[model samples]
Target: MILQRPGRLAITLAIIVSLFLLLPLLAVVPVSFTPKRFLSLPEGEWSLRHYRALVENPAWGAGLWLSIRIGLISAALATTLATLFSLGMWMLRPRFGGVLMGVALLPMVAPPVVSALTLYFFLITLGQANDLVAYDTLAGVALAHTVMIAPFAVVLISVALAQVDRRIDLAARAMGAGVARRIFQVILPNIRFGLVSAFFLTFVLSWEEIAVTLFITSVDAVTLPRLMWMGLRDNIDPAIAAISVLLIVLVTLVAVSRALHAAWRGRKAG
Candidate 1:
């Protein structure tokens, strides 16, 4: 089947909308290069002092390293749990699947503050018994992140699972493929892209998570976003603008590359 090509007017409108949405993000680029200490656009003079500070400042370096570490751990945990939950629902098609899904997606839909408070109280209680899950600890922050972002991973993996044929699973089962073998060899390979996407998505969510992190962490697990929030709240540092610019550029590059790849694949398929 042939698809209708977008009209020139439609394409023009899309470009305009994209640029408008990106305006705020683009504005940060100039501010990041400002010679001033505070957040401001570059004047006739420009400097990379703020960007340099990202490396030189011990707090920034520590926050960045901590964020990376927590992001990885939480992403792995969330992906593993999401994969298992999503695969179970897909295979079992249980009577309470809808209810289970709603419960799983609650974190995604609930207000950040609500989730944070819930996690905060839970961690506080858990920490009383287990130091590992105590408030202000790295493990606590990681667990909070995992809880907050797992819903997103579940949604993405479930969408991928929806596209998979049920008959394939039945065929594998009829051929005497055990649950473990079918999952590893059949299901996982088929959803490899989705799993990768979920991993990266959850990692990004954890990296940028500040609301819950703020509730669960203190000096012990100050993430990049938490540090940036502190900097913004205490003093409007240009260093935050530098970090924002870097993140914006990185995300834009990844989005563009993925779009190009998808278009190339579409053309090849056609």
Candidate 2:
């Protein structure tokens, strides 16, 4: 048996890259359990004082609540609008559809920092033009998130919509299905996977959003990421480390559970 040198080299390189990316994340696990006030691994003692702080501190809870609320709202808004737009574009198949698609995708390609600054100015102008509440508000933040997240949903759902057979639509039309009925009965059911995927993907994006959130929110609207950023500047408490560890554990469990479920489903299908 001859060993494949290239295959072995590629596997070795992949392992090195994975460890380099993941070792920093693992470091936080030990740092969180330290008895020390700052973020360092304990020599011999371990404590949950950092984790306890999250429960004891009202700010942490508020930040978490705010993040969830904003993430849900923004993600739903982005998914809904993107789904509608993608479906319309697919059905219409306009002559300038390519141009429209390019515009829809601009948010993702544009520089995030530049976009954040531009959005900040737009929010201020919008508030003043309406003679209503001016910038640094939840509404502003949500709007920013919606725009930032919509491009991803549009791209994903469009691919799914394209995969759908066009003959199904013609059959629905011949069967006397109205526009709305055809959409709900035919188009949506076919693309449910893409819709679900878009929602979860956008939700995760909004949950981890910090750049635009930082620019938009001023007071009483601090999201978890923003709070963590503030903590980094103001304090070095292991509570931040504890929070990091919690996030790491949750993500690991979710990924593992998803993989197991997929494998089980594959076995059943087989």
Candidate 3:
């Protein structure tokens, strides 16, 4: 079949857009390899010194670990709450579902400054100001992130749940299968991919979150991005570039793996 020429322009435009989106990341990878301590294009030599420094530095290591811990905890909390909320919305009436979903999405759609200010004030009033439960505490940071990312989780999980075939539930009911048994044995298995995708997305969102974390966390509970922000303020170091490169690589790998898994599952399902 011959394609129309008009569509060719759209394809070309898409390629250009993709390249534009990828340029900064492409530039960063090479810059991470620069031998100079300061930010610059690669000159005479390329070195892995920055990468080495990142791995060997205690502060960076601790910050990275803290970020990972917080991200995992927040993701788990968000995923659980979102899953239940989405399920409730799906099972209930349209008006109820719409209201619940809208409330869930409020945190994500609201202005960052508003969220930061509100949380700061709320925590202070709750007597968490200088205590372990205060702004800089790990629990506070995790809770803030959970609230921030729950909306996204709900949206993703709702999509997954929407894709589920209602007939499966009907059939199970016809056979006298209980709701718990049906959900565990039939529904979850079908939407496994969506759940996995939701988990990864939630995790990544929590991992990359900086705005709320920056305002809510102190030195002891500072996340990797927050630490990087402070480090950049003091100096422009290649170590930051190295950390950025590592993060990019990690996220890319996880995304690719999810895509491959989804593809493989699709084939198997077909």
Highest TM-score, which number?
Answer: 1
> In order, what lDDT does every prediction score?
0.93, 0.89, 0.84
Candidates sorted by TM-score, descending order? Answer: 1, 2, 3
Q: Candidate 2 has which clashing residue pairs, if any?
A: none
Candidate 2 lDDT, 1-270, residue by residue in tens: 997567888999999999999998898988888988777878998899989999999999998888888788889999999988998898889999999999999999998898889888888888887633347666667778999999999999999998999999989999999989989999999999999999999999999999887787777678899989888888776889899989999999999999999999999999
Task: For candidate 2, report its TM-score.
Answer: 0.91
RMSD of each: 1.9, 3.3, 3.4
Each candidate structure's TM-score, on Cα atoms with residue i matched to residue i, is 0.92, 0.91, 0.84
Residue runs of model 1 more than 4 Å from their true location after superposition: 260-270
Model 3 residue runs over 4 Å out of place are 1-16, 125-133, 255-270
Total backbone collisions, model 3: 1
Which candidate's lDDT is highest? 1
Q: What lDDT tens digits, residue by residue, belong to model 1 across residues 1-270? A: 999999999999999999999897888889999999888878899998999999899998888898999999999999999999999999889999999999999999999999999999999999889888789988899999999999999999999999999899999999999999999999999999999999999999999898888888877888889889999999999999999988888888999999999999999999
| Candidate 2 regions with alpha-carbon error over 4 angstroms | 1-17, 129-134
